[model samples]
Target: MIFTTKWYETVEPAGCKQRQSIVKALGLALGLLFSGHALSQNLVTNPGFENGASGWNTSGTTSAQIIESSGRSGNRLTHWSADSSYTVSTYQTITGLTPGTYRLSAYTIGGNTDDATLFASNCGNQNSQTAIPAAAWGNWTQVVLDNIQVTGSSCTIGIYTQNSDWTSIDDVNFELQSPPPGSGNDTAVEILAGKGFNYARIRLLVTPPDSYALHQDLDYVIAMAKEAKANNMNILLDIFYSNWWADPGQNWAPAEWFNQDVNTLENTVYNYTRDVLNQMAAEGVLPNMVQIGNEVNPGMLWNLGNISDNGWGNFVRFTNSGYDAVKSVSNNIPVIIHYAGVGSSATSWYASYTNNGGKMDAIGLSFYEMWHGTINDATTTISSLHSYFNVPVYMVETAAYWTSSDAGSTTSYPQTKQGQYDYLFDLTNAVKNINGFAGLFYWGATWTQSNNWLNAPDWQDDDAATRSLFDSNAQVNPAASAIVDAGGLSIRGVDISEAHYIESNGVEYLDN
Candidate 1:
């Protein structure tokens, strides 16, 4: 539910200056059947412009020309005007496509003062354009235009720079991208399961504001639980306890429950949790583990459960209500208290919760290198938490970027496939070495460059596209191997059925 933005400066045809943030829309145009088969051939002729634009058409006030010794591979196409501002375009029309979705990609580097886009137009659906960041100069950055549905037989693919100082493009490629594989059709998830991914962590929202992207309703959760069970994977249901996103910065109560007093709100929380679990149980898809609330380090349900304003007493009361509900339905389901990030703040958050008599069977933490400290720091924090709390520790969420295009900040990893693999491998080893470490889950393992949801004009672009286990092509990347090898054979020694239990009518626990 984290969002990031990349802005682009565009010049309108009416001589108007406009600045817009890239907001990617979720889902594709309906009724367009995309085959799962991908075409490996690069459809663009003279893709690198090494042959001096043999198959390209250059147009505009300042014509784009091919230059040697500047291409990402051999020769790059560049456009610039020192005398005055001008527009230029280097393009090619691809015909006789297979009538499916296509992906256009290219490496670009140029000055920040100009507006440039790698675009695809005249296809079946609406035109798609990916802005080239102004700061991408001096370094080759790959930009992609995905989900180009080709209902016809042709599409225009090119790079256009308008009213600019200088821009350069190289190694342009246009190829067909396979559609998302259906359940049991996703080779990547199957591979992860084969490699040792026993649990699938799914987040549920009460009623997501954006149903297309943030949709995690009860039906959705039940369906996912059924899929995980079918795949022989355990389920970790993460309840956000809010209508929309619930993170450290914002955990607003659902609109209906926002006005309730403390006692009323506590009862509401218990009833809601019990209802959700009861439904899941009826469908024979009850989760193996349930988190009371996601990343509640800042507390949930706003003023009623916001520890900062109302203190831990109210927060603990709400949390215990949720814990009680989970136990009411099934004693086998272990309750996890999830906290975001790791450091002194995390330690203090847990300490305060435990001191307030909060109930939890496991400690779950979210670790991202850019937000949290180093991997070693995470390991140290994990060991400390386990030692003090006497509960199993789980790396409930973690990921590394396989590309630098959307990576906001720099890290020790190289932002390559291998770098992603290495980061995960080392972190898994570090945590596994700890005696109380339970397991790990790679967040967004199946997220791809296509179907970007966080792209509404009000929201920022989805920057986590490159952090997925799959590449833009929807193929499993090398980083997935690290996850498969790290915990493929190890099993934690906690039994959901016998380790803990609670009376059906009360919150008191009977420890095994």
Candidate 2:
């Protein structure tokens, strides 16, 4: 069968039962081209650019085509597919139809093994989209969304497939008997961040068995990326080279690569990094910034981990390999070198990596104070490194807990509320003092936990309450609120004169 990545068609269902009603409606209002037409009640003539909700959807977050404003060029439909596992795309959702009219309609091209189902239902109700064969997979036909009623904000949109092949969706959008205002534009990120949160981080996974920090949880990795992207949040994707998960303490090799030679292993590592990077680029899911290695207190790829003279060569090759692999996909994606902070291990690792010509876009560190050392010591070391390394530094992983009993005790530092508050305030302040420092990343917010998920009947609290910026149920904690709202107390040596402003609006012109 032939595969197509793109196709644009004027796909409107052709039928007798619907034409008369549409004609009646059209007669009442002056007819105009969809894109240009703007009725007093309806904003845009064609709100659903796809023209049909075929092979795609606009309901729920996951397993649906994403709807985002294409910058300023109106709205857009983005699909982040890593490979053949996913296909089909549309940016259309239908609602507010009359009692007699169905909620969804679509025109599709044939090539499908079975009839393409157009699934839909009224909003606020159970969503179901069942398709009527318009055309085959290679041919064009009109598909009507049935079992739907026009109701408030509720709309059903999705796809039903019988053949298990990559699906293709094109020009699929809404078919409202009468469309609404230009369409309210709001991003999930703006919505969430408005509620609080300034930065978002997504974890990217390598192959299985040797997974990086994700521990081979590729599904969660994808889910997290989708969630952050949908929220329109800035992302810092953390990458680990191992197939499973790897950090300073554990960097287990995948069972497959166990027997491979060091040279072959290095190449394997580079390829894995590059392949995932390329996949992310294609999906447009690549983070604003990418961290090549996580908590490399010892080193990454093992081949370069702990030899004095051999440190530079192995470190250089390993880092450069990952670096080159990423640059090969998109050079603009900044690469960060992450280390453990407070403790001397991370600092020593950085000394080795950078000395061996391992280029770093950003110098990142993780410090828990309890695990590493005193907040003052960690922040001071970070500040000194900024001046010495001539590179900007940031607290990549640092948290000021809020009444979390599970958190390790910092007896000398005190575990009271005020102490927790003081720790965060001081630590953040120190980050502010570093010259090249960007900002602090407080590991972050917890949405829903194991105890209180929608399906878990026994899940009582629902608020997992680990290291959440927000409380158990997503309520803003004092620490997070204090930082975003008050800007917290001052850092000893921190100079945020540059951060005070937007800093070039995050854009710069090239001389060349």
Candidate 3:
């Protein structure tokens, strides 16, 4: 995580020459470091405008000028015309560089008029820009334009503003970034593990039609399970038992099983579940917990097992078949019955299934704040479910946005990085407070717009982007720290039956 900035200028800018010399002397005397790198130098000249706007180009009706006592460092550059509206740009062009990816960053604040951007262009790719939203008018926010492919040996980096209010920029930086290690998948899992997540939850679809979008087939899931094992994490395998996305409303049977009668469909479910687990076990990646049918509040396998249409008897039969299959694979793997939300309806749904002789080792709930109730509601429901069923309860899926975009209903949180962090911190604490709450999982932690399988509307789509814990560049967001901190807290009612069994048997669990 070290950054090295290469300063191209040996001479200080005009007005602040003496001050710059003093600062440099102090830095050398104290053995100061830049971005944690002792030898790192800034590639942008007069990055802080301490040199009186030297080594910079300005265009438009009003020229950008250096302003005193208003910078993130010593001084800053500002584009403001109080008398009239104007468009301006303060840019610096760096040339004669090695051809590779580079990152440009700057600290900026104040833009209430029109939109503005911190941008990089002509670096051997399409122009890259990070917009400074109109609401970013007071607090200083770090804006970065990364992954700038410098193919032509040069790139233009700067801020372009079309505003009547005002804008301030400081500490501009342009640095060459080394290529990342892998496809970013392994790094993402590692990041989650480092942040205190002990289990990796993956959804598996049976006989998916498309290989990309609905790609979590048996082989794909086995590969993912191996990855999780390699990362020293337990796996929670959620079997959808359908050919495509399966949720409360759309739990259709797979195409192959669509026409089967109720009795045959039950056997098919058992066989499919057993075969999936067998494959994973053969690969040495058997899941620590197996979820039979995801978010099946309405029942799984469609009409054949639909509780309303076919009665609780058929639904219970289908569910028990899957549960029996899990036991057949290994009695050690706990079985979880997943439901979509919290409340009386969900409680009654589970009650009916269990009353009809359905079996499960745990209860899983998808608790999204917008769709489900508040944190208080979740805590109450989790406690009730655990008490009623005498089984462990897990918040198997939850998420909050780090950016204000169209993901779903509005949340009490501000939809910013800090807002997301606060929400998760509060939610985690609430879950921990409830006795017997198994654990919590942040759903889609590694999802991003670039995930081809997601079929994002466009590059600008926020459906997945807003809620993902990682940004488009694969960088971990601030909310990850919340998860790390949450892991440190103790849950009062965690079930350690499996752990106890492992210890009592003298099993040597080796870290992969």
Cα lDDT computed for each candidate against the true fold: 0.69, 0.47, 0.67
lDDT of 1 at 15: 21
* Highest TM-score against the true fold, candidate: 1
Model 1, position 100: C-alpha lDDT score? 51
Highest lDDT: which candidate?
1
Give per-model TM-scores.
0.60, 0.54, 0.59
Clashing pairs for model 3 are 5-41, 6-41, 436-493
Q: How many backbone clashes does candidate 2 have?
A: 44
What is the clash count for each candidate, in the order shown?
1, 44, 3
- The digit string of per-residue lDDT tens for model 3 on 266-345 reads 99989998998887777788888989998888888997878779788887889899999999989999999999999887
| Models sorted by lDDT, best on top | 1, 3, 2
Q: Which tens-of-lDDT digit does each residue in 1-512 have in candidate 2?
A: 11111111112221101111111111212211112222223312243443333333332223534444431134433434334443342323443232222334444443332433444432321233333333344453444433232222324354443322323333333445532211122222333345445456654445542111122233334333444555445567677665654567755456666666667766876787777766555555665777877776666655434334245566566667777777877788788888876655556667767777888887887777667777667767776677668776767776555564453454344554455557766666655645666666766343323232223343333222444444443444455544544364221111111110111111111110
2 against 3, candidate with superior lDDT: 3
Q: Candidate 1, residues 1-512: lDDT per residue as tens digits?
A: 11122222232322222454443453433111222224377999999888987887766753434465667888887767665666767777886454456777777765653577776765632455656655455677666666665543467788777776777778888887763211424344344565456787878778765332465666555645555566577888888899977889989898978999999999999999999998888777788899999889889999789989999999999999999999999998889999999987788889999999999999999998988989988988998999988898888888888988473667888888899989988887788879788888778666564343232464355556688766776566777668556663253211111000011111121111
Q: Against the hidden true structure, what lDDT does model 2 obtain?
A: 0.47
Model 1, global lDDT: 0.69
